[model samples]
Target: MAERLIPRQALEYIKNKKLRPAFSYKDVWNEEHAAAFTVAKTMQIDVLSDIKKAVEKAIENGTTFEQFKKELKPALMQKGWWGNKEMSDPLTGETVTAQLGSDRRLKTIYSTNLRSAYQKGQYDRTMESDLHPYLMYRIGPSLRHREQHLRWNNLIRPKDDPIWNSIFPPNGYGCKCYTVAVTEARKQKYERDGVPAYNPDTRKTVRLPVQTEAPKPSYRSYFNERKGTLERIPEGITPGFNWNQGQSGRTIPVLQECLKKAQNEMPEAVDSVIRTLQNSTIYRDQLSDFVDQAYKHKIDGKANYKNTAPVGFLDKKLTEFLKTEGIETSGRNLIVLEERLILNGKYSGRHTDDGNAPIQQDWKNLMDYLADSPVYWDSRQKKKNLLFLKKITESRYLKIAVDVLSTERYLKLPKVDTMYYLNIATENEIGISEYNEIMKLKKIR
Candidate 1:
């Protein structure tokens, strides 16, 4: 039979996984496997990379298990990683005999990695789908199955159901189980007619009514020898397999770590890192998504808004300049607080009425304005603010106000009080005078 084609989503999922070298599978741990690719006893980066590359190729080409083993066995044998070997345990710093590579190990690695990648990809696609909001658990083709898995087969639940978080497929080593998304119409049909069952005579699945309410979970205490902890894992799931891969795989905490590191570096290095981050597609996409979500929350009448995204860092020159003016920066990064943007009832309303309030598109350009525009000290206010002005045309400009004093009084860091457009052409005398005063203040870039 021709091999089934792999989904592009599945391919992308595997392609994007970060390589993590680990002495034991437990080193990487549960949902972390979704984002990090690892293999037990693979401590060397080169060996791990080799294994990951082969896996990637297998997934991309739909290579059979035998074919994968055949392609990889020679490389492993040549690299001295193919048989039982004596190696030092990184955790205990002791020499121990460990299984390195063999046919059985190769098969398990190949199957587990491929299954996880496909499952995670499917989960992401299912969550994003509006039409097919229900998920039905299906048992994979195998001679025998776990009793609990058999009981859970054909169980229908909403995509957001917490049950999937604990029980979404591949529940154990060599446990062939998966989920399929179905529409409400199909679910209704299942209710009226039946759930799907296989007809051996027709060689096709047929509808049956065997599916029922989602089963309540039963837990078992499994002592994890590697971690040396007794943990409660859902009964059907393998000790290290109880997590929603798709949900956990999407996080990018590495970016935040990088930002934190940048905060402590020299001024030039921090500025360079900030500039690179601002120009990155990932950062831009994250900022845009936050703005869109904030807008949705505002219109939806949600309160106690606490979401925030870092827009840019302060220039040290500006920090020192503020210090001279008796304003302390406290060495904190400036952020665009969601509450300040959407929940400042009257303040937001006034800007909206004046045609100066920042629209969704303006938020996208904020990082660029913060990084590249001329920053001026607003000396008129009791609590001096930093003004970032980017000229849009001859008379129109984009203005972003960063309230420095709020850091000392109410906030953890300096924040943008308001972002709006300024049109000098249409400004009243008072407004023009204020603009002139700002232009005369020291320009720190």
Candidate 2:
């Protein structure tokens, strides 16, 4: 039997020149949520081919559809059976990338709706409508990822990290990972019941709820094993050695040691110190102490201090350096901003966080020490590179496509196979009422 290509119904996909069947796998294989499609009458044949496989698997198990449902409920705990219904791609032997919890009748109904749209040119936009089209497009693959990660995706330990050492090795490289696609309607059904609408191929009315956002990977989770070693440093040493004005220099390598210890044990305290150092007065005081301690300057009493040139100008110089890097001015808001930036890069694409900022060599040394310690071991290194690329590409593509599709010049044509072709239809916005009116004209049952 020949393989079947289950195409999407969105006109944007059908009429898209960039999404030819030849290149459709690019969309299929990526984390990006764009669907590949084309409009034609025979496409339903493809869906039937897919259905035939599900039926065949049922028959192979010596059960009819009715019998399979009962057996499947228990058998779903088995490796091959994921949910009440078993799904697979006959061509590649890959699992179907739809939510397992969706209405089983939805696929049959959606098929009917498409048949109607093909013949009568109308149906509830909510029923196999563009809204549902995009909604399924997002959530179908989301289920795929959640399943893959929980079942298939493995964590690899870094060579230097002991905790993840046994977690498994990394992907060879260029691994194409798929994540969950989420949308409002699918969410409602999932919440009301424990099941998600896994069958995007199905078309039935399932209540929609607001989308559940995917959870983000946190720094702590990534580097949990290293947290233990990073907390030993004292606060004073983390800043650096400092001496009084015009007095004999004091030695304070212990201060540097203290800072190093706090890197893991006390990040909040570390941050506090950084902020304190940002103040010109505190920075100068600390610098003077550091210089005096290092034998670079002499600290004296108030009279000597007044007569002497300003101590430690390095603090102001360091502040300017930090600004050139991604660090923002010190404040509560900026601190939160820094945290977000450090983890996810700039909230908006236009800016980055303070991780890029230049710091005093002492600060750098302390960070390097922390990096060596277990606490900061799982800090941003490998994943940051991947995340940076993912953010840029996904944001750019979605924005561009939506901007084009919502424009008037892209008026849709009623094409075969429930697809939209670019034609002479009015380019006016297809309002919710207009969509409903079109459905009413078709007399959807």
Candidate 3:
């Protein structure tokens, strides 16, 4: 296939690997040179280094299969990397060949590189617009195609559809299958152009599920390539295809959806966001608390510090809190603490409730201890995390909250509804008029 047919999205992922392959998995789990564009472990590092340069060049230029074989053959031969031998990979202790000139190998290499690039590109295109939620597999017109992957042909499912994670195209060796982004428009277009293969019987189209129950091992199985760390596939991705070409840096479409919601009014959408942990798995740990303390409890601009951290992981959730005032974390110890602050304080959102009120003096004493506490005094660099905790406990808003919870009006709200609304109103940082409106609700509601 020419560069034009090589597939752009696949190139997007491959392009990322030019600097560093963005995945790691167990060597034993590597079945059939997974993402062959990556540096091979079987070859000596020095030998692989020369070979990688040519491979990278081919990828950069979109060299066709023939073009790659012609250019790389001479280089591999000159370096005496052309012959095979019984070999063991120093890294994984796996047996693989270092042979460079097999025609079959070149063709396989060409197809693998070009095909993966194309598929990755196609997947990305689906994410670029609102039109398509599902990708439909298209069987390439190869005569001897594998049967199992063929069974997936004409199937259209969501980008996040769990099956898509493990069963994306190229499901096996020499697999000649491709996927097309499917949208309502395309589905209709196909109906007009003769019933699409998706509905071979020409019956009414049936919508697919957004999620599939996790398959039983009898139905399907998944293998994880774990060495030291569980191979971190792209947040929601599957195994084997772990090493990202270059696509990880792109903004995720799902996250974009969240930001899109932010363009409107109050932070209700984000409050349900859960703000921490796995990108693939939707969660809501600190989000509820953030909503409670800042949105639910209503901190407004009352958090301690007159400036935000100048250096550290720039996160929107934390930055949202740094609206007008926050400390500039400049000192080395404080800067280290800044990272911890964002990690824990930024999202580790907490609030005081009437019945659950903390000891007001307890927080006061902790603040006093921190005021006198030296930075980096301990062997473990915990000063950064401690610095964040100190700010949260010492916030004037929190102190007042501890006192407010002790009051009868707040403490005696027996029903959760009463408590919930009160927290929402106060934590939401409403103006005096809104606060008065809430107060009037005490009489009206």
State each model's CA lDDT, in order.
0.74, 0.25, 0.40
TM-score of decoy 2? 0.16
**Which regions in candidate 3 have their CA more than 4 angstroms from the true location?**
1-3, 6-12, 18-62, 86-88, 91-101, 189-247, 250-445
| lDDT, model 1, position 65 | 90
Winner by lDDT between candidate 3 and candidate 1: 1
Tens digits of per-residue lDDT for model 1, 1-445: 1124557777777776767888877777675575578888887788888898898999889999999989888988888887888988888899989899999999899888788778877887887788998999988888788988988988888887767768987788897898888899988888888876776779998876646587777899887677675778988898899876756433333334455566656545766776676776555655665677677777887644556666776766777787898776554555554454655665368767776666777887777878888898886767667898887788777778888776433336777887777768765532455567668977887
Task: Give a tens-digit lDDT track for model 3, residues 319-415.
Answer: 3433323423111111101112222231333423332233323322322322222221111231212112122222221111101011123112101
TM-score of each: 0.58, 0.16, 0.46
Worst 10 residues of 2 by lDDT: 397-406
Q: Please identify which of the two predictions, 2 or 3, would achieve the higher TM-score against the true structure.
A: 3
Model 1, residue 335: C-alpha shift (Å): 9.8
Q: What does the lDDT come to for candidate 1?
A: 0.74
Per-residue lDDT of candidate 2, residues 348-396 (tens digit): 2222131222123322122122112111011122210000000112211
Q: Who wins the lDDT comparison?
A: 1
